[model samples]
Target: MALECINLEHVPASHTIHAALFQNIKNASFLHQQLLAGNTEFEYALIDASVIISRLHALAAIYRAVNDLLGNKLRSRNVHSEIVFSLSPNNNIAESFRRFGISPETTSLLVIKVSTPSSPAAGEDIQSHLSKVVDGEQVDFSDGVLRAMTDMVRVKKIYKLNYSSGVNGRGKENAVYGSDRTSQDSKELEMLILGSMALRGATN
Candidate 1:
């Protein structure tokens, strides 16, 4: 029952999102297979949590995907898959899926289901559906949970960031919050990476 229904800013009311974080998943491979098989019941965006740095890092990707969906500009199969694609800095859809999508070994997971006017399912309905299929303990979708799930080494590698001291792009280092070095730098890196991924769908 750890599912959260989030009302996004600027998104239409008909597009409420249901997001959940799962830990110590026992059926990751099964779930991954379901997605690969194109099971209609497994339409939720299943993300590998290790590549995520914070809730906003995940939210930024969701925002960009949903925004594109609203504009009829989806670059992938659907909004759910596009959420994973939006996390990548490049436009390679399959690579994005391979990197961010669930795998056989993924233990920590992020599940996102968008309820649009075309497919309006209540939060309770989505929660019930996930609870039955996903074999993991649901937890709050907060920064603390997400931070523990993040793999710093993998995140830097995925984004091709040079150093761990700080993120280098769009003057983000200068824009970093004045706080503890480790945590503050991580936040900056997440922000910088989010900005980088967001720029992929930018329009003139």
Candidate 2:
């Protein structure tokens, strides 16, 4: 199956994370409508794959959301929405949805489902439902796949990492400097993103 079951560290065993990546999605508008209409079956974190950097980036957001859910401090409606919200550097819930969540223009998608004790969804059930509802090609959810799908320009813009005097000052196309340079830059960007997310939580 394309669905990957993840066991996050420091999270309760009762909360399991299931994730999938879809490329060339054909029914983005339909999926977006389902979220807008509050379809219970569509309670998944439908993230725009372009904004995602790697599996770690996505998992970090999932961990934060689930942790909040466990503490009963969720700022959004549920753990699913909280996952998307956790990606933003600010506390603007609606803007977070618009920037990170799925839209009609989204061609690639990162779908995440968190199974909690209150709503225990089996991995098989999630895989089956996703196969039927999401019209796209399911690909392995891995760092390589995610890196290929990432839109660095958009990601830098959203995270405000485009400054000309910081870690990203080397410019977005640092790949020309060699694979090692590219890898180093990506790691720095990931740290900056995580720091921003943590700072937002601290302020709140």
Candidate 3:
């Protein structure tokens, strides 16, 4: 897997992000434990790939988290944890962690870290660190890879999606661009989730 360097819109140069996707992870518990223990070396955002629908899904959360970090409105301990929180439709921090954070059963994983002047030059060494600690094969971060990893049933349950009827928990009110749900695909589903997440932060 390669470290994807992203220069987000309006975000400062120092906030550039380096992210990677992995699969067949074997030490998820240990990785999760490291995060739980607040290990500085494991500052990367370790996400359960099964819950991520696409690269955009992951990016949207990252964008929100970084935005919050820049604004000093972060609801979690840091930008990494905020990414997991941004993925949730609702704003329950702990539940978001439980659902999206890495676990012993998590086979596919996504790792993200940010570059800043004050922080260690972790982005440059991300691939090496991940290779040493994560027992998994690195893969290109793409929608095809994420799509295969996504759990449709659990995704629907988490987002309260009912695509069979093209409505969600908020019904037509939550649909974006007035698009109906009858012909939804991965693209439409992604849009719906993004819309909901946007509204969530706005309301908060």
| Candidate numbers sorted by TM-score from highest down | 2, 1, 3
lDDT per residue for candidate 1 within 1-204, as digits (tens), equals 567988889988889888999999999999999999999988899999988878888888899899999999999999999999999988889999999999999999999999888888888888888999999999888877776677767778888877665433322343443448856667677778877786764631
* Inter-residue clash pairs, candidate 2: none
List all candidate RMSDs to the true structure: 4.9, 3.0, 5.7
Write candidate 3's Cα lDDT for 62-162 as tens digits.
99998898898999998899999999888889999999999888999999887766784655588778889999989989876776677766888888877
Q: How accurate locally is residue 18 in candidate 3, as Cα lDDT from 0 to 100? A: 88
lDDT of each: 0.85, 0.86, 0.81
Task: State the displacement of the C-alpha of residue 170, model 3, in Å, after optimal TM-score superposition.
Answer: 25
Off by over 4 Å in 2: 163-178, 201-204
Residue 44 lDDT in model 3? 82
Q: Point out where model 3 deviates above 4 Å.
A: 165-184, 201-204
Error of 3 at 200 (Å): 1.7
**TM value for model 3:** 0.87
TM-score per model over all chains: 0.89, 0.91, 0.87
